[model samples]
Structure formats: C-alpha cells, structure tokens
Target: MIHAALAASALSLSFAAAAHADPIKIGFIGELSGPAAAVGQDMLDGFNLLLEEQGGKLGGHAIELIREDSQLKPDVARQAARSLVEKEKVPIITGVSFSNVMMAIHKYVTDHEVFLVGSNAGPSQIAGKQCSPYQFITSWQGDQAAEAVGKYAQEKGYKKVVVLAPNYQAGKDIVNGFKRYYKEPLADELYTSLKQMDFSSELSKVTAVEPDAVFAFFPGGMGIAFAKQYAQAGLSGKQPLLTTFVVDALSLPAIGDSAMGIISGGFWAPDFDNPQSRKFVKDFEAKYKRVPSNYAAQSYDAALLLDSAIAKVDGKVGDKPAFMAALKAADFKSVRGDFKFGNNHFPIQGMHIMEVVKDGQGRLNLKTIATPFKSYQDAYHGQCPLP
Candidate 1:
C-alpha cells in the first residue's frame, strides 16, 4: 500500500512538472507571403533572432512563436488577429507592416483583452481617443515621420511641394501630418489606390507642376513600385525627393540603385549608431543573408517590450493593466536610441533624416543627414486622454 501511494504521488509530480514546462506562446501576424511578404518575414526573422540569442526564455518561461500572414488586407488581418487571440490563446500579439491593417485589427483584439504590440503602422485613432492599455506601438505614429519631412522641406525653403500617398485613412493621416508642419503652398495632392502598381500617371502630374520638392508616404510593396517609377521618371533626383516611411530597408533591396539620393524621415534604421541596433543588424544579416528593415528592428523591440512587461508582472501576464503599465514605462533598450512612450503610447524618439547612398559594394543603404525632431512626440497627443 505504501509503495502504491508513493507511485501515485510521483506521477502527480511528473504531471505538474510537464505542465509547468510549457512554453509561453507569442503570435506574430503580418503580410508574410505576398508583395509585402519581405516586410513580414524580415520582422519575424528579427524576432526569432532575439529568441535564439536569449535561449528562448522570457520571464523564466520558454518562448514559442506562431507566425501568420495578414496579406496586407484589413479583413485578412482581422481574421489573423481572431485566430491569434481566440484559437491560439497567445499571451502577446505583434508585427503589422501596413497602417490600415493595423487600424482594422486594433479594436477587435484589444476589446478581447489581448495585448497588441505594433511593430509598425500607427493610426491616429489608436494614439488618440481609442487608445488602450493593452495596445502599445514600437514604431512612431504614421504622422510623426511625415511631420519630420514636412518641417525639413520648409527648412530647405521648398516653396511649392507635391504630396502623394495611397488613398486610405493612414495615407490621409500621413499627408495631413505633413501639412501640419509644412503649412506651405501646396502644388497638388494625389492619392493612389492601396494596390497601385503604376505611378506613371501621377508622376506625370508631379513633373508637370514642377514643385520645388516632392514628398510622399508609401509603405511596403507600394514603396518599392513608387520609388522605382519615380526614379525612372527622372524628376526626383533633380527636385530633391523628400518623403516619410517611403524608402526603407525592405524596399531598398528591391529598389536597388534607383533610390539613391532620396531623403526620408523615420524612427529607426539598421545603421543607427546604437549597441542594440548594431548587434541586431549584424545577427539579422548573418542569418537572413540580407539587411534587416525598420520593420525587423521594430519587431525586435516589440519582443523586448513584451519580455520586459512579462518580467515586471512576474510572468502573470494575465494582469492586463499592470502589464501595460510596465510597457508604457519602456524599460527595454530599443534599437532606436533613448526611446520613451509619449502620452499616447507613441514613441518620443528622434527621426533620422536619411539620404540613400550606394556603397562601393553596389548595395544601397541610408546615411543620416540630420536628426530632426530630437526625442519628438506627435502634435496630436493633445487629443489623447492619458495624462
């Protein structure tokens, strides 16, 4: 009888050990297998690189990741978000390349009590009235980068400027953000389709107007197409191409030498002189055989943020309010230097004004011309309720 009782106790202990050995699952959703797949895959690559280096442990629990492709569509993004929260029951959700998809998925997931860590794509609504403790963005709000471009253009004495973006809410937000700072005479405003593949028609209008400079906001696949067309048209190199979130590491590889001499503003870059960024860039390129984009860097930061929050909560991430407060504290070292959360959960970080340069090795890369809006916060924060 004693031997049998001991066996029963030992079995119970074994079961408890097994149960405690389960990994903490994180869901990563983005456009992983389409025109914008590179953006998503790069982000995932960066995320996994961190896990590998850290031995896949966060908050003393083994970490597991489930990756999904949003296909850069709002409905698809919503479906992915539902699966991540409902079916997988993941503790954290991360990665989104496009702003519209992020905006679409934000309310649904946040309402379900799931933490959504945005790697890119900041909508004004998320940063303003609809802000939630469960939602935090590693990337700057979409408008913040645009405002930098707008201010830079004015500083350069560009009297007449033409602006173009996809005909979407996020695109409108970016253009409006730029206008907030530029406040200069506008030559024309053009909105292309979200899936616009050709910009010849729009480029024709831009060149015809002869603006002092051209500012645009195009992300992911659209950026690759637009930059190629803009360079092909030959109006950009002469008039000074100024933009926000248009030319990035993901698009530059596809753009090749076409994007040389283009200036854009962004929160993070692979070339940023920070210890975290240097290690991330080196490891990511070594593993992926290509450069890590801002998407990748932001996704890496998202993981660090989650890990930091999970640690603060003592791995009891079920406490949403406490976990969120930890994230807002921004304790992790970001690849983008010295970042802190603004009132709206958007980052207060410098925006680098980068000019794309081709190295002797024939690879295109961004070199910083100036750091505009040092430790910047968006002007729309006055609308957020968080004190």
Candidate 2:
C-alpha cells in the first residue's frame, strides 16, 4: 500500500511538471451553456481571434486557452476558478459572465496570487474597498453604463422614471448610479429574482406606476428574455425604455423589431466610427457571421491588454509586478476608440448614449444620440487602494 501511494504521488508530480512545461495557460470562465451561451461564445471567439492573430502565442510561449462553463452560477464559477488557479496553475484568468460569479471567484484569485483580467462582469466591490492590485478590469464597472443612461435621461427631461432590475448587487449599483445623476422623482423601483425571466408581473407594476421612462440593467440571457417579455407585454411601444448593458447585441438580435427604437447607454458599439472599431466589427462579423456584442469587444480588449503586458515584460511572464505595471499603464490599442486605466484599474473611457436604429435594409444598428459623458471614472475609484 505504501508503494502504491508513492507511485500515485509520483504520477501526480509528473503531471504537474508536464503541465508547467507546456504552453502558458489562460483561463476563460463564463456561461458557455444556457441562454447566455452566445455572450460567452462571442467572448471566446474574440479572445481566440487575438490568439490566432498572434499565431497562438504570447511572451514566447504557446498559448493554451482553458475554458470553463460557469453555467452562469456563482458556485460553478468558483469551482472553475479554483481548478484554473490551483490545479491548472494558469498565470491569468479572464472572461467571467455574471457579476455574482465574478465576486465568487475574486477571493480565490486574490488569495492564490493570480492575476485576474476581467472581460465582462465588473462588480462595484472590485472597484471599491475589495479592489486588488492583482485584479484589472478590461471593461467598465457595473454602474458606468447606467450612469451614462441616467445622464442622458436627465438631459432629455425624463421625470418620474421606473427602474427594473434583477435584485442583485449589480442591479442596486446601476439603480444607484442612475439616481446619482437623475434628480427626478422615481415612480417605481422594481426588483425581480436573479433567475427570473418572466417580468410580466413587474411590467404590470410599471404600468400601474406610469413612469415617463423605464431603465434596466439585465445582462446576458436575462436581458434577452426581459426585452422579449417587455415587448410582448407592449411596454416597448407604450413607454420609452432606456437601458444599459441590457439591450446589447446578444439580446438585440433576439429582440428583433422589438429592439428597434430602444435607447441604451454603451461604451462601445460596432458602428463606433473608429478605425480600430471598424476593423474589429468587420473581422468579427466575417468570422462569427453575426454582429459582435459589447461583451465580444471587451473580450477582444482583454486579449490586447494581455498582449500589451506580455510585450512590455519582454517574454517574462514570471514577473507579476512588471506585467501588472504594463496593464496599469494601459498601453494597448483599445477597440473602443480611446482607452486608459482608472485609479482602480477599471476603464476610464468614453461613454455614449445610443439608440437602436434600423437602416434602409432594415439591419439593426446603434446610433449615437448624445455624448453625455466622456472618459468617465467609476464612483468607487476614490475608495480603491491602487494608484
């Protein structure tokens, strides 16, 4: 029995050594199944595109992508993160879908001393007191988009607005963000289940309140589901719906005609009218045969961020401090036009309030309405420890 145990331990050690000897592993953990799978798939596609462009390499090491399907569950995300950091020993982890799942996996990454590159899922805690030097967000925080929406709504003289969200940390952040800028009276504040797809009851509640506009922050599949239900319940035409991160490409196509005339706040869109953005839009459309969502753009930016870090470190990924410094410097061509890192390692980039407009051919496109804010910073940045 002692000999058998010795043999097993030896095999395990050998496997570990072989893994280390192999290519550099980067983890992509998100919802690869369920209704939100398209978002994860787009993120993976964009990340893979970067890898392919770089010939599947970074820092003189062959790139090996480790994908984990969180199924959009926090516990599942935590398990995947543990496997990546503890078992696989990946240097960097990226592409978490839900905010709760990101929160769940954050402790593990910080504790294990692994760098986390966030593609989506930007929780306020990561930007605030719980912020870590090891964590860098490739996208804006949860409230930035909603803040833009709020600013736009205020400018448009929207009063007595109704807010709908999925009763979570992200939801609260978005609502608070809107309220921070929107001094108007709130007609209703409705919270539904995190997993709730049916918003009929909530819509009914909104109808009763009769707000001038409705703002929401439903991400991923929930966004698609909620938008569809919102349209079916005739709220789309009845009331002016303003949203952020909810009516993105992932749900826009699903919402079809219902998505048309919908106004939302965004940091990046396919028709952003920048050279880098044009290239990304064309290439992603050719490769994926569909419009790339904001998640995809953020994922592509994450890859570029890693590439920049690797270049700055001169093929020495072993130096975590140097890599982190490069990331903090924000020395990459962001597909989102302009890019800079905030004090909290979150994006300090331009935010636009966009409306979904259909072209002559009836193809859905985002049209910029107003540049309510530019190069915005998250409210929690002052509270972060990082420079």
Candidate 3:
C-alpha cells in the first residue's frame, strides 16, 4: 500500500510539472503586408514587450507564437484561420488588424471552440446578435471612436457636416455611429471606393456642399492619400476635419505639415497621463524607436490580459471553462483607463476627443483633449444573448 501511494504521488507531481513547463501555442493572424502592415507590426511589437519581459513565458508556461499573415485579404485570412484551428490546434488567437479580416474568420474561430482576444476590428455584427462567448475584445468596438466624434460634434453644435467613408462594413459602422449622436442631418453623405486613392471627385462633392465640418474614415494608406489630397485641394484650412483611426502616430510622419491641429476621437494617446500608460509608452518607444499608436496600446493590453488569466488557471489553458471564466474576470490593469467587458464581450471603456498637435519638442502627436464617454457601452450590446 505504501509503495502504491508513493507511485501515485510521483505521477501527480509529474503531471503538475509538465503543465507548468509546457509551451502554449497562440495563433497570430495579422495583416503583415499591404497598407496595414504598420498596424500589424506595431501590435506584434507591443505584445512582445511584455512577453519578452517575462522571459518568453506567461503564467510559467513558455509561449510559442505561430504567426501567419492575412496580407489584408479575406480569403487569405480565412485559410490561415482554418490552418491554425485544424493543424496548429492553437487554443487562442489574436492580432486581427482590419474589420474585414475579423469578419472573415469570426464564425470559424468561435465555432471551433477557440478563444479570440481581438486586438482590433470590432465590427457591429459580431458585437450584437451574433456575439459569441468565445470572443473577447481587448480593443474598443468599431464604432466607439466614431461615437465619440459624433458626441463631440453634437456638443459643439455643428449644424451641418459631410460624411465620407470607404463603403465597407467598418466604414458603414463608423458612419452610423456618427449619425447616431449628431442630431442634425448631414450636408452630404459620400462613400468612396475602398481602393479609391484620388479623392478629387469626392473633394468636388464636398466642396460643392460646403459644410461646417467633414467626418471621414479612410484607414491605412487610403487615409494617407486622402489627407494629403484634402490638404492639396485647399479644404484643410477651410473646413474643420473630424476623423476616426486616421490622424495618429502611424500616419502623422507621412502626413507631414498638414497633420497639425487635426482632430479625431480615440481611446489611447501617447500622453495619456497614467502610470500604466506612461510605462508602456516609455518602454515601447525605447524598444521600437517610434511612437506607439492606439493599435499597439490595445495589443499590449491583450497580452497583459492573457497573462493574468493564464496565471489564474495555473497554465491549464486546455480547460476552456476555467480559462473563459478567468478572461471574464479581467483581473488585469489595462494601459487604457477604465476597461471592462460588456455582456457581448466587447470592451466597455471610455472614449475621448483626440487632437494632433506639436508638442514642446516640435513632434506632432495625438493628445487626449476631452473625455466624452465615461465607461460607454456599445449600442449593440443589448442585442447580445449573454444577459
């Protein structure tokens, strides 16, 4: 009986040691090429900052990141997701750059019983009726920043404005969010092609109407072209420009002289004025030799979130229920202040009116001007089933 007991104790200790020492596989599907590569690369850098600090381990388990580029193509992203799920058998996935890519693999990721800690791309469809328990967004919903912009416009009493987007799901969501709070009707609502680089025709349309403000949402390289063209067309000084996810660190260096004093709404800013945020900014800049954008900030939070949850479960990530519960608990301090999950698993966080300006060192950067929404939940959370 004593020998049998000794053998059983040895087996239990071996199992515990194996669990602690095992390497965890995480799928990183991102837009590593194309116009959005800056976004993806920054997210990876930010996530790596924490992981590297922990000696490439989270919750006492070595992390093995399996990276696959979506190349900003839906089909490519879908196939990558399939491979990660079926072949790699990763229990967790993160680093989706664009909303379109998120849409491509949302069903597959959740249906396969995988946890998706979305670093970006929070479209309305997944946040509402089709919300999944397996999906947790570390970033704000797609429309939250636009909603903040809308609220700012409403507060300023902008009676007439024009709206422009890329005519995609995310663009539509941003437009809808803008219209929701801006009580007044728009002067002109125009959507250009996603690949439409020359905004001359769109600019002509805007110039014809001549509104008090213009709200535009053209991300990645499209945004860079649009901003330059808008400036070149002599509309930058004439009309007040409001934007979402555009006038940030990623685009500012390219935007040059025209980026100054441009206004937008976002959740994170470099000078966010918090210990957590300051530390992240300092360390990230030290490592990357560049300014970190909101995308990077969101991805860093995802890593902190995973670390906290994984530690709680004693590295037994294979146990879905415990891992899910640990995620729901959100036992981590976010780089962004006041973060929590709604019933829909999207972040219930604050939004602020952000502005690009030259700091004391003559560097243009996004700075938080006003906090409009305090712990604002997305409009579609009511449609989720997790009441």
Candidate 4:
C-alpha cells in the first residue's frame, strides 16, 4: 500500500511539472522590412521591452514570441498570418503596423477566434460596424490624430489647407476625418502612390496652391522623405506644416532640423508629464538609444494590456471567452494615462497638439502644445455593434 501511494504521488508531481512547462505562444506580424520597417521595429522594441522587463514571462507563464515580417505587402501579410495561425497556433497576435495589412488579415485572425491586439493602424472599418470581438486596438484610429490637427488648424484660422496622403484606405480616412472637423476649403486634395519616394512634384503643387497650411498623414520613411523635401523647397519656414504622425519621434531623428517648427497631433509625446509616460520614455531611450514614438508607446501598452488580461484569466488563454472578457476590461496602466476601450474596442483617449521643437541638446523632439480634445472618442463607436 505504501509503495502504491508513493508511485501515485510521483505521477502527480510529473503532471504538475508538465503544466508548469506549458508555453504561451504569441504571434507578432508586422512590416519588419520595406519603407515602414522603422515603425515596425520601434513597435517590436517596445513590445519586447515589456517582455524583457518581466523576465520573458507573462502571467507567470513562459512565453514564446513568434515574429514574422510582412514586408508591407498584403499578400505577404496574409501568408504570414496563415503560418502563425494554422501552423504555429498562437492564441494571440499583435504588432500590425499598417491599416492595409491589418485589413487583409483581420478577418482571418478573428474568424479563427484568435485575439488580435493591435499596436498601430486602427482603421475606421475595424473600429466601427465591422469590429470583431477578438480584436482590440491600443492605437488611435487612422483619423483621430489627423482630426486633432484639423481642429487646431481651424482654430488658428487656416482658411485653405492643402492635404496630401498616400492613395490608400488610411489616407482617405485621415482626409475625411480632417475635413469633418476642419470645416475649411481644401486648396488641393492630392493622393500619391504609396511607393513614390520623390515628392518634388507634389511639393510643387503645394507651392502652387499656396494654402494657409499644409496637412499630411505620411508616416515612417515617407515622412522622412516628405519633411526633407519640404524643407529643401524652402517651404518649411514659408508655409505652416500641420500634420499627424508625420513629424513624430520616430521620424524626427531622421528628418532632423527639417521637422523643426512643424506641428503634429498625437495621443502621447516623449515630454508628456505623467510618471508612467516619463518612465517609459526614459527606460525606452536607455534600452533603444532613441526616444520612443507614439507607436512605441501604444505597442508597449498593448503588451501591458495582454499581461493584465492574461493575469485575470490566470494564464488560461485557452479559455477564449473569459480571456477576451478580461482584455475588454483593459485593466492596464497605460503610459498615456487616461486610456479606456470604447465600445468598438478602440482607444477612447485624449488628443494633444504637438510641435516639433529643438531640445536643449539641439535635438529635435515633439513638445505638447495643447489638448484639443480631452477624453476624445472615435466617431465610429456608436456604429459598432459589439456589446
């Protein structure tokens, strides 16, 4: 009887060890290559920073992060998503950097019931009537940042503004959102090819229109190219450039003095006066040797959100319904401070106006000017049917 009891106890210990060794696999798909690679790399750095801080574990469970480069192509993104979903079987996927890429794979990810925690590119469709219960965005919608700058320009009495964006879904959404709030005449609404690098011709149009202000939504390397070209054309000092996500921390370093005096709008800035924000900025700079952009902040928040939700579920990510419920709660201390999930699963947060200014060290950085919309909610919230 004693020998039998000892054998049973040993078997129980073996099962306990196996349970402890189970790994939580997380899939991260983003444009790790191509023009937008910097954006994706910043996001991955932020996400990895959080995991590193926690000793590479989440909710007291070992985590295996599977990263795939989408190469900024819809087909590539779709293929990467399939590999992560079908073969790797990650319960959660994150680090989507572009709206077009997200739109391509969102349906497949959600249909399979895998939670997609977005770090960037909150498109209107995903934030509104088409919102999936399995998808959550820590980033602002494509329009929200532009809307903030639009209101700022309107208040400044800019009568005619020239708007330029890549001819894409996000570009159109940004333009529409800006128009919705700007209520001013558009001098020109120009859409350029996504891969078009040389904006000398586009800048010529802006000079011809001679609008009161120039607003754009170029991000990543496109932003660098535009800012440099705009400055070289002597328009940086001549025309007031107001933009969204264009002259941010990520792009400012590359654009340098070209981004100076440019006004942009976003939810978080490196100079934000919150303890969490300060800590994140300081730590991120120490780790990455560069200031963190709004993209990095949002991605870091996504990781924290995952950590919180997984904890609530006690690491039982297999319990899909309960895990999603925990995620919907959004019980994380966001670096942005006043973060909450709208009914549509997008962030309902404030939008602040920022100006690119040279710091005491002569390095260009974003300085918060004003909060145009405090506790702003996206326009598509009411359209979302998710309860």
lDDT of 3 by residue, 99-216 (tens): 8999999999999999999998999999999899999999988888999999999999889899999988899999999988888989999998877889999999999998899999
Flag regions of model 4 displaced more than 4 Å: 1-19
| Candidate 4 lDDT tens digits, 274-326 | 88888898889999898898889999999999999989998899999899899
Error of 3 at 116 (Å): 0.7
Candidates' C-alpha lDDT? 0.84, 0.85, 0.90, 0.90
Global Cα lDDT for candidate 1: 0.84
How many pairs in model 2 have backbone atoms within 3 A of each other, for residues 3 or more apart or on separate chains, i.e. clashes? 0
Over 1-387, each residue of candidate 2 has an lDDT whose tens digit, in order, gives 999999999999998886567677899898899877887888898888778877897645578899999998888888899899889989899998778888899988977878899998888998999999888888889888888889888988987799988888888988998898898988888898887888888888888887788998787778888888888877887788898877776677777888888889878877788787888888888887888888899999998888888888875666988888888987878898889888888999888888999855577878887887888899999989877
TM-score of 4: 0.96
Lowest lDDT sum, 10 consecutive residues, model 4, at: 249-258
Stretches > 4 Å off in candidate 3: 1-20
List the candidate 1 regions with Cα displacement exceeding 4 Å. Answer: 1-19, 360-362
Best by TM-score: 4
For residue 154, what is the lDDT in candidate 1?
Answer: 79
